[model samples]
Target: MSPVAAPAAGPSATPSADRVADVRALSDHLPRFFRLVQALKQAAGVDGRDRAALVLLFPLVRVGPLRQSALAELVHADPSTVSRHVAALVEQGLVQRVADETDGRATRLLVTDAGRAAAERLREERTAHLAAVTAGWSDDDLAVLTELFGRLLDDLTAALPADSRPAFPAPREKP
Candidate 1:
């Protein structure tokens, strides 16, 4: 089999052209990044049911009490899907439904102490996974990547119309 060729340097392209190419490259590479994160999640050793529960658990822990609909919006998942996972979480004692103080009839989802502990373990393990993945990179490089990723998310969210945008919270939060 023939070896694959390296991408062209595009040395003669204008700066704007170069940037546009970079953006295109980013679009192409974004899926790989997601897959890497998915791999990391799998490596965290959660079961299939656990995987779904943890998805909703971490966000609910980070954002505090939220209605089921809001949690669905926050995760960009279907409300019905969130409802099913939430039921499992409640059954597993990872989350609890509480009455909204503002409205007696309204229900909100809250992560339990067990949920917080589990999220913390997963968060730390994720960090260790990242550290291993980026072991060759400089600290400055890590910091810059974090800054750029945050800025990229902010810019992308801002580009959306106010009414149509999903709930985009800060990536990191004290739990």
Candidate 2:
């Protein structure tokens, strides 16, 4: 096996060297983060079917009912993929199609009572799990992490082409 060489920095990289290093660090940690999240989800007793339904359930629960296309935009997923997830959710009685109030001809996806219950349970369990993981961290450390992560997401969103950008809700002001 041969060691990989880092890419040579170019003119465009002048001002972003530190940011590039940060991105590399994030890339290295993401797999571990994802594995931990998956383990937590599994421990929460979220069955595969219901776990898959979370793709649709999350947005529906957060933003209220939305047209399929809008849900796709929010999740940064393909419309067809969202459709498939929505179909599974509907079959599991987690979500339902509702008439769009503003446009009668359009249908929106809404989470059912059962779906809300499942989502809340999963959310609570995840929160508890994360709290345990970060229990030793001080309040200031946690606050810094939250602020930096939000900033990273905002910067990434801004870098995307306008048409390719996802529809994230505006950030809420801290009380």
Candidate 3:
């Protein structure tokens, strides 16, 4: 795949006028957008540490049951971190460990009904929040933005070197 642009410190790193302006705008805006999303998830999530735990439910809820190892890879979290989150979720009855029918030694994490309710509540809350935030935006505008944002994310992910690490690896715990 082709790279989007050159890296800093490279002799070819100089940007043309338009690309520089667009890149600058993205650099300024995307972080704030991400921060708002994270904050919204935290606020809408159950409480305290469960806030983080609840966030983990999004992937499982979206894709159905998954092994802890697969879930960690999908979420780009460390195995130990995923284990802790899964433990808390199981304890809270939001998720359960079930024997993987194909492999007696392995278990899949399934979201309980309570977990679905919590996830739905968080989804609704986020939807309401965004609707309010985008009150001034027209349907056409929203559609355009959605399409553009999706394309941007796809391109960004594609731009990564195949050998590079996943985007969000949770730091490993200390010994």
Candidate 4:
């Protein structure tokens, strides 16, 4: 990439061509960010199969033992699709199904202890990877990046309006 021009240095400086160029340069960083996240996920030991398993397991871990219909809804996947993934996870001993006490005919899916361990390992790996990558970053630099990210997300969320947000709602209170 061509070098971006430096921003004007003045107490009352307004946006300049150089500042525009810099902002444009920053916009191009998103692909790099995506690649980094993908690499981090791989380093966390998530493969194609395990990635799918993680998608299915996340809801179980978050919402506890839930019915297949509820799990599917939480995951935003069709019941059959979630069922197949859950079946594979169950066979692998990463998830378990228990008879629902409230409804004997229904089964509730729960992540096994092994599954929690896997999730924890993945979390640790991701945290360590991010820490190592940002170890040399100054506090101000990190803070500015964090703030920029928050602003970007705010802009995106504003564009979507309330109805278009992800279907996942806040956890409901149990009786």
Q: Give per-model TM-scores.
A: 0.79, 0.71, 0.75, 0.63
Q: Can you list the residue pairs that collide in candidate 1? A: none
The CA lDDT of each predicted structure is: 0.79, 0.78, 0.79, 0.73
Best by TM-score: 1
**17, model 3: CA deviation in Å?**
1.2
The predicted structure with the larger lDDT, 2 or 4, is: 2
Q: Which stretches of candidate 2 lie over 4 Å from their true place?
A: 1-23, 35-49, 101-105, 170-175
Clashes of each: 0, 0, 0, 0
CA lDDT, candidate 2, residue 81: 83
TM-score of 3: 0.75
Q: Candidate 4: where is the Cα deviation over 4 Å?
A: 1-28, 39-46, 147-175
User: Mind giving the per-residue lDDT tens digits that candidate 1 earns over 1-175?
Assistant: 1222344578785556666677688898899989987876677677866787786777787678999998888877888988888998888898989999999999999899998887888778777877898999998877777767777888788888886575646674323
Q: State the RMSD for candidate 2.
A: 6.3
lDDT per residue, candidate 2, 44-144, as tens digits? 68685567667567768878989999988887878888888889888889899999999999999889999999788867877787789899999987777
Question: Model 3, 35-65: lDDT tens per residue?
Answer: 9867765666556567778878988887789
Between candidates 1 and 4, which one is better according to lDDT? Answer: 1
Error of 4 at 138 (Å): 1.7
